[model samples]
Target: MEEISKHTIHEQDIVEMILSIGKKFERIVLRGAYEDILALFKKLKKKEQSPQHYYQEQYDQYQPSAPPIPPDSAELFDYYCSFEVHDCYEQVDFEGKGLVDNVYVPLLEKVCNIHPSLLECQRKRTYKYSGWAFNALGRVSHFLETTKLEEMNVDACECLQMLWDEVQVFGFELSWLAPQVEFALNMEKFMREVEKLEEEKKTIFMRIQELRMKFKEELYFLYI
Candidate 1:
């Protein structure tokens, strides 16, 4: 118990020291701080309740349990192939025709744009998990590079490769300057659309097969 208390005190002191140094150099970006913060985040995140335990506890207590998701359409997940979606997805040369242009590129760019913003707390910066953006950046880059083009899901929901999960905690900012948080919120909507599109695509292809079969049968009866 005494050892645990000492560790907690040490953690608290370290967090305070970091925040103090960051604030002292608020207008200037700390050299190497960005990379350092990014590297330490994994261990920091493992700390009992994170370096922002008190802040998070307060945040959770006051904040609403959930945000209401607005009604939406999946128009953004559009595919413009002259060929049917089922056929496009099945063909070897399709090369993720629409997904590369629309979803993957945009999502990658969005992740790339987020930065740790260490020590330059001009106006709307939150120091909570200060360098978490680096994790998001790395996670996104790895996911994009490792995922085969032919097998890439537009909404990024591959079995163990869920985009959201890959970039969850530090990926989204927990502070007032939540650039990543906005992206994270947008992902929620994207996943919901994925669910809708998957079902619609399945049904549309089934219907297409049925109609083709019907047309063939009618022609055979008429001609024969």
Candidate 2:
């Protein structure tokens, strides 16, 4: 095996790092290869930090559970292609497609099945932070339907809608204020609809009040 250089931070360096730290940090191996080497470097530093500062120490205090590995969809597709009847993944020149299917899929399914609560939290909307919940929900929803999700005990089945709603809210406000080149078209259309609706609502309210006042005057006149 060719030894990866210390300064080079390519995918190969990550593979080397994982293999080097495997015995001490089997958990790190579960992360997707798509994660950058720099990110892995930060994670490795965190792992080495004192038990008091991090949960890994506390987690290891008790018998720690195995890290959950998500199935690599790319890998699974490649495996399917290899069946001779189909060769769909041949066109895409991507690495790690095989490992995703072989290693990550079963691990992710098991983790999701066991910890639907954790998954549900991730599925919640907090766009200011990580969008893992929405991303995870999209992936899961691609595989399973809302009816099937009922079996999993998820409280918020509308995670995707919520994510979209939040994005629209943020995008609408930002677009209206900044109207950047990318958002100009959508922003103008959205604002026009919003303004029309507001004007229509105000008109309806005024009409209702006018009718009420007319009825009141008519009643007072009849009494006099």
lDDT of candidate 1? 0.33
Error of 2 at 8 (Å): 76
Give every collision pair in model 1.
none
Query: Residue-wise lDDT of candidate 1 within 176-202, one digit each (tens)?
Result: 323333333344454455566566556
Q: Give lDDT tens digits, candidate 2, residues 1-224.
A: 22322344443344455446545443343334313433544554444443223322332322101111133343543343331111222221112111122222443455445544434543333532223222232233232222221222222223322323333432122222122212222333444544565665565445445434443343354346
Off by over 4 Å in 1: 1-177
Worst 10 residues of 2 by lDDT: 61-70
List TM-scores for all candidates, in order.
0.25, 0.18
**RMSD in angstroms, all models?**
31.8, 32.9
**Model 2 score (lDDT):** 0.33
Report backbone clashes per prediction: 0, 7
On TM-score, the candidate that comes out on top is 1
- In angstroms, how far off is 134's CA in candidate 1? 16
